[model samples]
Target: MDFDRKQLTNEQLLDLYKKLLKPRLIEEKMLILIRQGKVSKWFSGIGQEAISVGVTAVLHKDEYILPMHRNLAVFTGRDIPLYRLFSQWQGKANGFTKGRDRSFHFGTQEFKIIGMISHLGPQLGVADGIALAHKLRNEGKVTAVFTGEGATSEGDFHEALNIAAVWELPVMFIIENNGYGLSTPTNEQYRCENIADKGIGYGIESHIIDGNNILEVYTKLDALATSMRENPRPVLLEFKTFRMRGHEEASGTKYVPQELMDMWAVKDPVTNYREYLKTEKVLTDEYDEALRAELKKEIDEHYQQASAEPAIEANLSEELNDVYKTYVFEEVNSKSNSENVRMIDAISQGLKQSMERHDKLVIMGQDIAEYGGAFKITDGFVAQFGKDRVRNTPICESAIVSAGMGLSINGYKSVIEMQFADFVSTGFNPIVNYLAKVHYRWQENADVVVRMPCGAGVQAGPFHSQTNEAWFTKTPGLKVVYPAFPYDAKGLLATAINDPNPVMFFEHKALYRSMYQDVPTDYYTLPFGKASLIKEGDDVTIISFGAGVHWALETLAKKPEINADLLDLRTLQPLDMEAIFTSVKKTGKAIILQEDTLFGGIASDIAAMIMENCFEHLDAPVKRVGSLESAIPFTKALEDQYLPKARFETALAELIAY
Candidate 1:
């Protein structure tokens, strides 16, 4: 059969063959290393080289591609140094992740490659973010993300595709249908005859192609990417192929049928492509053999150099250093002009001021755009900043948060709001796994602020009334800020947005319209890790944040004779330990209050820290006041009893008297 190069020249055709053969050679070498115990593990992409190579060949250098564990050619085809890749595989200090993660779990921003998380589906939403950034900037850059057929069952896949289609962002949702996801076959994965048909539900153009055929893969992607760049829109391309190996080297392939393996072996992409190149006169058999030899030599030399590099040192401080970006807080001038503003308006003003200052700041939520959000915090934002800056997302928390991380990847700051804090559970995986760990793992900051309206008082039931700040305070890489007053709310929010780390900004829904304060009219920022001294006295110390601050104040106002130090811990993650210890030592008595339930609450941690640090200065035992350990009831009467308001008042009285 005569080879039809189509629009590709002879040089391009030969280059594709070289790209296809390199990963196959690299995988073969890696398998040997695995057996020799030089390499720990590998997700071999032996038979599936054509999909990554052909797709990467069609993409521009500036365009981004998020590759999964099985897409090794995407890295090699992009001309990333072999030494660096080998260094990563060998757990060397010179690797992309500094030996923090194994296999292809790390990404390099220089190469425009976003590595996939183990979840397998969140990267699709991240692709939506990168594509959104390109669309927002009119960059004409396209993003391609890969996933196996089994990951199609994930909600993130559907959410990301729906978001990309709705926004008309230039993205290629590449599904490498490699027969099985781990041990489960594609037949058990989904009911649809073709994964491409799932794209129809999302309004995205879909196609199924012969993934083993390099010419078909390259030609189709080239035309599709060209059209997408010219007129931005998302499309789905399902590549029918087989995984040729186990999920990982250790898993083994006993679950796969013998006939299936034999059938795919004959249709091997690398061997077939090599034979085609020879038949087309692009290379002789001798030249092909020489090329393979040269590539093997190069891989061997690179591996040797990488193996000689130093391994990661076990330094405790160094290991903890890059978890968050160091932020220098500029003290706001206290004498700045002030005006009375509600907590909601204060947050709105802070967001408005931030949007005005940072051109790249984007706000995303379900009803935030024209609907003004659930609390009406951004009532007129869409009218002022337009829809692009204030994007209304679907009811997909996982995708929205993942997209926020994506926007941060390309030098943009994003603020993602959960309608109510309770709904954040839907977005929990991305927040804890990807957003929190990206900086620690790869030295890349996911500069995102997730505004969670938390706490209970309005009888909104179990779902909407959760005070889940404790959920993330235990997370290492995230910064947790829960403000009590309008002044602190505005200032802390400004700081959270400016800081180069993921922040969980908890806004108590009960405090939105209830509290009013004289806040700074102009832009200002309050430093984190500092507690706000709401009131100063000498008898007892009351430590709290968010709605607990108000309850403490109410209790303190009623007891004029009982002088107390009211400390509003503005940020939870960067807990004001110094302030806490100082107040606890001075008073020699402390009562920690929280809106969350008593068991496993942040208040318990605070109480423990107080006892640990201020054990010597103990006039009385440390006391904790929190809501009952039960789901927040829907009735106002039960809610009042369930809340910590009465409990806090009693605890403060007992502490003062003791």
Candidate 2:
């Protein structure tokens, strides 16, 4: 379809010219600064300004855009103050990320922009989440995400596209085929005719356009965005473009053939748009020169102002703050009414109660809706809450986790379940890189709870049985919760769901059905960082969590002579060191138990802390007991031997005798 030039007024045409020109001028200024050592690095979008400018210009302000490093025009087109962006690049406190991240690696909620991480494709999943929010609220808003052709090879790209297509989400998957992925050419990347063709495989409407032509890009994108708002669905647009410079300033373009450079040089988006406007009498040569001069002056002034701002100071307390939003527990009277229930039922009750309390709570995972998940934890959720809130997802761990993050971005709380604990390794990048770092990087709350059904006991073998709590406990900006009893499972799950930071809630598969207790019927929450004192004595302190707590209980019951102070640590990230110290001080001996291997488990960390804090009070050395360092075997006998039950019993007796 041809672009109707008559559709735009003369003033709007002039404004588009300015939008295309400003980023080009800014890139030139940034290059100068890089040469002068004022700026460290830059991803040049020098020749590809039209794609960013035209696409952003066509979108509404309330709509969200996730832009990569090269799309500087997206920021400029969104009317973000030049000084603030400059401040961010200069590592000033006033920048969007407050100097936590560099360059375009940060996002600003104020501008409805979600910035890219070093891993390019995760943001596509995040875009799906934002689109999911839009679809849920019936907001008629579309989410636009930008990526280079090289990133399309990532699994997240396929996952995000398939999810959007399956759900018919309002998302625009925009790809800039810039001829190279760092030094590798397009032919080496994929065999498909174009990136948009891959979208067709996913049943999405795909289009290809001349990226150098500003009019074509603007008109095509505007029509697509309008249609999407009326009928919510995903579309892919591939803009065939060229990289005018190296990937970054340090990487020289010695690999590009001179002929290709010469060919693309004349087709520059900014320069050709300027010539077209002047020839059409929309902009005079005199006005064009004045506009260029004005843009240069503004860039220089903003750089100066940003450079003059204060740099970040090194303060430990201040730096440690804002990892999580402060959650104040409401004081509720303890109801006398209670009923005996299994751990699985208690967790289900907690989720049902939380869903009743918060209208924005959403639950998603594989076979979770009608099938009620692999373990039947969400058995009746679909019937009670409907399929919209309790969603069934494809076997895409990475995308679903990121979508949950996106939902949290729009004030919705999400509970995403991993079918098995061992499967979390597939989605580790987004969890560790994006969800765990977003708040610290840009102060955006990732209100997501990932339910991990973990631990080894049911002969499910290595693939199904694994204790992965230690994986997330070491990561900052994340909460790790592991419950032992039915009561603690329900209360802590509720607390984890309510917290404003990302949480990894580990449910031991072995304890899900075996453990039972009288759980409170009414809504309640257990605070994190507080350990439940199950039994108190002076012989020794048995510190453990999850299934390890059960083993410790069995050991104590079998040996009636040995008295011990048993503590179940409810949360690992916010560890209850105070309780451990108090118990160790009274007992003067301690033993840490865990289901993970003994080589590098959380038990070692707890033992180290106990020794460091309560060394003088100890009679015997702090004992550490964990599973054998090998993959869990499927046989019942081998599985029992692989676990830490026998080790915990031996360690407890040895510590008491010592």
TM-scores for the candidates: 0.98, 0.99
lDDT by residue for model 2 over 1-658, one digit each (tens)?
1234659888988988999989988998898999999988899998888899888998999899999999999999999999999989988987888778898998888889999999988999999999999899999989999999999999999999999999899999989998999999999999998899998799999999888888899888999999999999999999989989999989979999999999999898877877777777898989988999999899989889999987788778766886766668654444758999999999999999999988999998999999999999899888899988999998899989899988988779999999998999989999999999998889898999999999988999989999988789889888999999999888888888888889999999989999999999988888889998999889999999999988888888999888889999988989999999999999999999989998778988998898888989999998999899899999999999999898788878888888
Tell me how far the alpha carbon of residue 238 in candidate 2 is from the true structure, in angstroms, after superposition: 0.6
- For model 1, residues 52-117, the per-residue Cα lDDT tens digits are 998899999988999999899999988999999999988788789877898889888999999999
lDDT of 2: 0.90
Question: Model 1 compared with the native: what TM-score?
Answer: 0.98
Clashing residue pairs, backbone N/CA/C < 3 A, model 1:
none
What is the lDDT, from 0 to 100, of the residue 298 in candidate 1? 98
